[model samples]
Structures are given as C-alpha cells and as structure tokens.
Target chain A: MDFRKKLAIEPGSTVSLADINPEQDGGIESKEEGKEKLSGILDEITPLQEMLYAEKKHALLIVLQGIDAAGKDGVCWHVIRAMNPQGTYVASFKQPTEVEKAHDFLWRVHQRVPAMGQVAVFNRSHYEDVLVARVHNLVSKQVWSKRYHEINNFEEFLTENGVTIVKFFLYISKDEQLERFEKRLEDKDRQWKISASDYAERDRWDEYIEAYEAMLSHCSTAHAPWYVIPANRKWFRNLAAADIIHRAMLDMQIESPRPTVDIDEIYRRYHHAVREA
Target chain B: MDFRKKLAIEPGSTVSLADINPEQDGGIESKEEGKEKLSGILDEITPLQEMLYAEKKHALLIVLQGIDAAGKDGVCWHVIRAMNPQGTYVASFKQPTEVEKAHDFLWRVHQRVPAMGQVAVFNRSHYEDVLVARVHNLVSKQVWSKRYHEINNFEEFLTENGVTIVKFFLYISKDEQLERFEKRLEDKDRQWKISASDYAERDRWDEYIEAYEAMLSHCSTAHAPWYVIPANRKWFRNLAAADIIHRAMLDMQIESPRPTVDIDEIYRRYHHAVREA
Candidate 1:
C-alpha cells in the first residue's frame, strides 16, 4: 500500500475527529518535519506578515473543501495558528440565510474577504454550491454546473486585484467516513455533534465525491491551485496544511508595510506632542 | 481634573502597545487577570454562543464609533483579540465601494453580521450614515435624519431575534484628538496614517459631535444602549470595555454546551477510539 493507504488505516477504517492526531500515531514522520519547517518558514515570512499589515495592500482568501469528516476545521485551526492574530481572519460559511439566498452565490463570500493586511480562511467555502447542491439536487444540475466557471472568474478577479487564494480539498475514503460517523454516534460528548442530516449527507457520499473531483479538475488554477490533501491521517493532514500555508505566505513575499517614520522619528513626535500638551 | 482630563493634556499621550501595563494603569491587575476575566465572560456565555452556533440564530452587530484617533482600532484589536477566534469577526468600514454606494445605508453593515455563536464588530459602524455622511453632506439632512429611526428598528429586529447589539462611542476631547493627530503627523512612521482627508474631517469636529449626540439620544435604548467610553486613556478604555463585555457575556450566560453523555462516557469514547485505532 502507498503512504496514503497506510495512513488511512491509522483511523481504524473509521474516520473520527478524535482519531486524527499526529504526535501519538507516529505514522506520519513528514508531519514532524513539517512542524520544524514551519518555524523556519515563519521567520522568513515574519517580515512579510509585517509588510502586509503596514501596507494594507492585499486581502488573502483560503478556501477549504472536503468530504464529510474530511477535517476542514482541524486543518484550518492548526495551519494558520502561527500567524499574527491581528493579521489573520477566519470566516466559516454556513447554510445560507434568507437574505443570502436572495443574492448571487458569491455575495456572502465577498463581504467577508479579508482586508489587504488580513488573511481569511473559508471553512467549507463556495464549493458547497457544487458539492452539496449538486448531490442533493438542491439546485438544478444546470444551475449548479454554471457555478464552477463563475467561481473561477471570481477567484481570478480577486487574484488580479491583489487577493491571494489558496484552496485545499481534504480527501477521505467512504469506509473511513462510516467509521467516523459510527464513532460520533457512540461518543456521548461527540454525539451532540452528529445530526440526522449528516447521515443523510453521508448516504450520498459517492455523489459528493464525484462533484468534488469535478470541482478540482475545473477550479484548480495557477493563481490558486487546489491542493488535494490525503486527510485519512490527521497528523499528516495538519502538518501538510501548515507546510502549504507557510510556503504560500513565503511565496507571496508577505511583509509588513513600512510606516513613514522610524523609531527615532516616532520618539520625536511623542516628545513634541507631549510638550505641546 | 479627572485622570481622563489629565491624560488628555498630553498630546500623543499613549504608551507603547508592548509596554502597556494594565495593573499599573489601574485597569485590570495583570494580563492574566484580563485573560481570566475574558475567559470567564466567554465561559458564562458559551452556552448561548453554542446555541447561537447550533441554531445559527441571530447575527450580532457591534458598532464602535469615536472621534479621530480615539482608539476605535485599539478597542477593536483588544476586545476581539480575546474572543474565541473562530466565533469572533471584525469589519472595518472604509470608503464605500462603488457597489456598496449603489445600495442602501445598511447594505455593507448588514452583510458583515456574525452568524450564530459568533461576534461581529463594526469598527466605524452604520452610524456613519448619520455622523460622517451627515457632516460631509455625503447624504442630505433629510436622508441622514431618517437613519436614526431606521437604525433603531434595524437593531430592534436583531435583538428581537436573539442578536445582542452593543454600541460604543469612544469619547475623546478635541484637545486629545488634536494631540493624537499632531503626533501622527510628526512621527515619520505614523505620518502615512494621517491623510489630508483626516484633517478635513477634523475641521468638522463640532458637526460630528452634534451628529453623535443626536445619534446617542435616539439610539441608546435598553436593549442596545450605547456606552460613551472615556477613551483619552487607552488603559482605562481597554479595562472599562473589558468590564462591559464581561458583564454583557454574563448577561448572555455564555458557556460551553454540555455533551449528551457523561464525562466518563466521553473518556470511554476517547479510549475506545484509540483502542480501535
């Protein structure tokens, strides 16, 4: 079996949130290496992080899409944890409101786009239009199919206008998902987390996968290429995501915008303001 | 003179962000205390936050408005800094986009409201429709005058549906503001922060204050009372605001939602998941 297949077994042929840990499993050595690599990456990007804040020039949007139990929240929480809180923002797009449905598909997503100095994370993201909507027949096949092109164009506009996009697709198997769902049922605290709707969604897993694969094939682009992460191994998933984000920040040359004044000038201004006061 | 007045005497009278000592400044005793208090507040309302999350209940809309350099950003940075990062969001409104101007006054503001268990902050808020837009003649007296009732009703709708609206007007004296503005101009690093437009805004100080007074009188209801913070002193501002939020969270009774099963059951689930893996 390949590394992905071996890691898949780590979750016990079941996909549970509790099962996804990097340190205890010892299955994904790459995760350990990824954590160490993060420190170095952070050092280089620290300046860029500062510049991004100072200049307030570009907003970054990261979109995470995956199968049920695909670890979207876990990856997001761990991946961008290293960033300066002031410079990062996370927006999870949930089920649409009455107001949201009245607008175009991109309306709600656009309002939460991080400012130039901010990094924004979209958990689940616009892909739902294709994934969920496609699988459930929530919208006509024609209506949902048109969204892929619309999404690409929307991302292209954001990228051209200084928004950097990083998209990730957390890939997990159906067997693994069933194991996770059963675990959720069995665990009391976690029992609250499961819903009948989740099972209803799970029943259509194959259709969802087809929708996702089609999304990956169509929407992945140079400006915001979608990284298909084998998320069966929780540790590897987290480590891989952190590495991808760290590299993206570096690749973008993220830096603090330089203020017009230096420390000395600031000191002078303080004194003058104090003296005048 | 009060400490606020005394502090206002010194132009650019602010401590370094790094050097801020809450205890010495008579705010909270220490950063840890601040953290504890914040966590306590979160713990108290966590249940509500979760319910909001589960039900995807009302969207929260917090409005922060103040004079030039009156610590709107500072309050935003710290108040939200302590929030559960996943559930808290901040939106700083700048010049309106062409698309935004094409819509009604609440168009942009409404779009950014936090969905269920989340906190959404408006750094400048929709009061601008009456305050800045009124002062600048961006909107007519009739247009701006009508916004107060509209805003009250808008807030009423949010509150009626479970959204808690907290509005704060950071109150800073003209002398204090002049001090801050002058400091910004003299400090090379901060010089870029002050634009020609900021000075233009300063010229209409009285008009802005008048607009604010009208707004405060009209909109400060029991449900969404506006707290006029003494903001010349940054430490006090942070502390006072923290106290207010803590109180509000207590009122809301935030707490982590209880699991359906007992603690032992959860432990068993954890153990079982591990064993099965």
Candidate 2:
C-alpha cells in the first residue's frame, strides 16, 4: 500500500525531524481545503459514532505518534469530537510513573483499554519504551529491541479479544519543526510549552527517527498498519485522521442491539409524560 | 432567570429530575439534532477559537458539579472536544491522595489552573470540600463553612488576573439516577462502572442535595453563576453545556490577532517554493 504517498510520509527516508524545514517540498498541503474536507467527513460519520455506542461489543483503539509540534492533539479534537461521549475515552501516556515502572510495560495500558462499545485513544502509548527510551539510551538496546515483539503480541491479543487498532505517526520535516518552535518561543502565551526537554530531544532527532523506522519495520502488521502523516500543515493532519477514523468505523458497521422494549412504545409513553406535564 | 425555560436545559428543573420514572416517561429527544446543533456551533465558533489562540490573553475555568449519573463526564467530552488543543486543558478532582490531603484545601487545584488564553475545566472542583465532604461528614462543619469565603476569594483572584469562571451543576432526580444505575447493572459492559461507592453515595441523596443547595446559594456570584442543568436526557445535557460554553466565549468577544505575515506573502512564498521544486 503506498503508505508514503497516502499517509504523506517524509521524503528523506533517513532524515531527522529537527532538520526538515516547513518550506521543504512535498511536506505540506493546502490548509483551507484540508479543513473543509475533514469537517465534511466528520459530519458524515456522526451516525456511525452512535452505532458503535449502541453495538457495545467491539472496542476501538487509536494510537498517535508524532514529533513535538506535529498536531497529534489537534487530530484527536477534530476527528472524534462528534463521537458519543459515553462510549469514548482518551488516555495520555507520559513518562512512566513510579507505579507504572514497577509493573510490566503493558500493565497500566491494559487497564485503560476501552471496554466493549467504546473507543480508547492513546496519545503516546506503549511504543515509548522502544522509541523515546531507546533514543535516549534510557534502556539497554537488547531490552528495547525485545519490546517490539511484546508490543506486537499485545496488539494481537487486543484484536483477538474484540479491539480494533488504528495507528498513526505524524511526520514533519526538521525545518518545519524549528519554525513552529520559533513561533512558540515568540508567543508569550505559548512560551510555557517550551521546555528544556524539547530542546534536548531535538538534539537527538536523528536517533528518534532511527528508532521510529525500526518500530515501523518491526510492528506494522496488517491488523495495525502504521500511517505516517505529513503534519507540517495542521489542517491536513486533522483531515487525514478524520478520514481514517470515518473509514474504520464504517468498516465495522456495528448495529444497535435489539431493544427489549419496542422503541415506538417508549416514544409514545415519553410523549404522554410531556402532555401530562 | 427561569432555568427550566432555558432552551437546552433538559427537563429544566431539579424537581423534574427528581420525579423521573423510566417505565412512565421514556422521554426521548432527537439525539441527532443535539449532535447537529453542537456541530453547527463548533463550526460557527472555529474562527473564535482561532482568535483566542492568537490573542492568548484570557484564561477560562469551567467548573462542573452534579448529582450521581448527572453526566459531567459526558458534558466534558463534548464541550472540551470542540476546543483548540493548544489552549485547552482539563483537571479532574477525585478523593484526595495522601500527598493532596496534607496540603491546603485548594493547593492541588491551584497547580492545575490554565495559563493565559487557555481553558481549564475542573470536574468536581474545590467546592467538593464544602459539598460532598460536608454531606458525608468527612470533615467538620466549621471547616467546611469557612471554605465558601476561601472559594470566593480564590475565584476572584483568578478573575482579576484574566480568568473567567463558568460553573455548572447537573441536576437529576433520584428516580432518573436509579434508572441509570439499573441500566448499568443490566449491561455487562457497563457493570464495571458500577461501584459500592456509587451506591453508598446514593443512599445520602437528600443530604447531598441540601449541601449542593447551600453551596450554590452562598457561592454563586455575579462572576460565576451556577447553571443548574436538567440531565435526565442525554441530548438536553449536551446541548445545555454547548450553549453555556458558546455564551461564555461570546461574552469574551475573542478576536483573532492579525497574522504575523500577510496571507498573500505567505502564499507567494509557498508558490515560489512549489515552482522551484
């Protein structure tokens, strides 16, 4: 499947995120059109969102991975904004807490997986041990390498047990990231978002890219294929994400379980209450 | 203000929620219509969201309070899901951790307040010390009573420094809650959501309502009016929340800041880059 073209994967297959410029060719798209398309798709998918909630036997898992300013949060906000609130949950994984560190890598994650008829989103997920931890030498190479198989097994388990997984990696060039960083620095309100860690991470961009490549090569199974989105243009990132979610939900075609009570009878009684009141 | 007459405010009164009987009043509104209205509002407010991000000077604090099964989390997912990610945040307050218990009442809260030009939502806020804690007798009445002034002062501090507080209390009848609880029990997927704590809390419904009323009377100020939402119907709950958020943002009249570079110049640079490529 030409993932690079469909997902807008970066041109320099080996380049670091800190080195790519926003001005780089093939790294961005028309913003207005992208946003318009995403909104249209979100509208079309509203019914499917309700259907998934009613069919509460299958769960969905969405994974987001991106560079510092690659619009992962924006993707989440736009793509799933119309979903049934009761049937959706989002969990953001951060640096391992003391509690998390004590357990197996997947322990905390397993607890947060969406139950039947729900959608669970992972902002940054279990892959961190192999990505960030590897880039920073936080864990030994042997240990990190072994985790790829563990992650694959875990995802396979989730699929077998009724969870559907959709994974995305936001790809933006180094130059574009630098420009966004500079913009954040210039805006006083956004200054707090800048951290020493971001700068340090930028310094190791190449290492992260290498780790990401290894992850994609090892874990991009048919059940959970990785989509590398070009994220220099925030609008395009959101559109691609919405489109992917819409397609996935439509494919599921979940039906509302048969109600024990006739819906028409329920409606008649409801109207009767309004009449009496 | 006739809260019951509020267009989006579900059944409209605390009295209504208290009287719900599922077998009798299977009240159903077009859920799709509420979803559409919320979507329309989001589209209308996109420019405002963009403007707020550019202005980045005003901070928003939304406070949610409700009876059990009153839909606070549902409200959060809809309203918060529509916001711009860069300038939005959420904090959910639960039973205090050991670290939290040692601090001043508002200490944990003070740490989570949003920065200028951002939105921060508190799910069950500092008022909990006065509401739930007081009702359960977890704290002395003397301590709880003093908290009203402290809360007023804390909010005033935030407002004077550019934060706008928006508080909502989800009101539902004892019967409606029982219906929801029953639904949870009957549905295997939702059974996990039911807990002994929920039942224990339900047993003191009247006491909690008294506490809520007292807290509302004392702390609902001109700066932050408590919006009592009838939440027996999910559609009404989502719409009521959207209306409040829309009104608050409108009151601020947030405008987008002028672009740093003219659009023509940006497009020209883009076109030039495209030609070179």
Task: Report the number of the highest-DockQ candidate.
Answer: 1
State each model's TM-score restricted to chain B. Answer: 0.77, 0.83
Q: Chain A in model 1: its TM-score? A: 0.80
Q: In candidate 2, what are the lDDT values of residues A154-246, reduced to their tens digit?
A: 999998898888888888887777777666655644554565567668888788888888777677776676776667777767766777777
Q: Is the docking of candidate 2 incorrect, acceptable, medium or high quality?
A: incorrect
Score every model by TM-score: 0.68, 0.59
lDDT of 2 by residue, B48-122 (tens): 665675677787888888977888877776667677553565577889999999999899999988777677788
* Fraction of the reference Cα-Cα interface contacts (below 8 Å) that each candidate reproduces: 0.14, 0.07
Number of the top-ranking candidate, with lDDT as the measure: 2
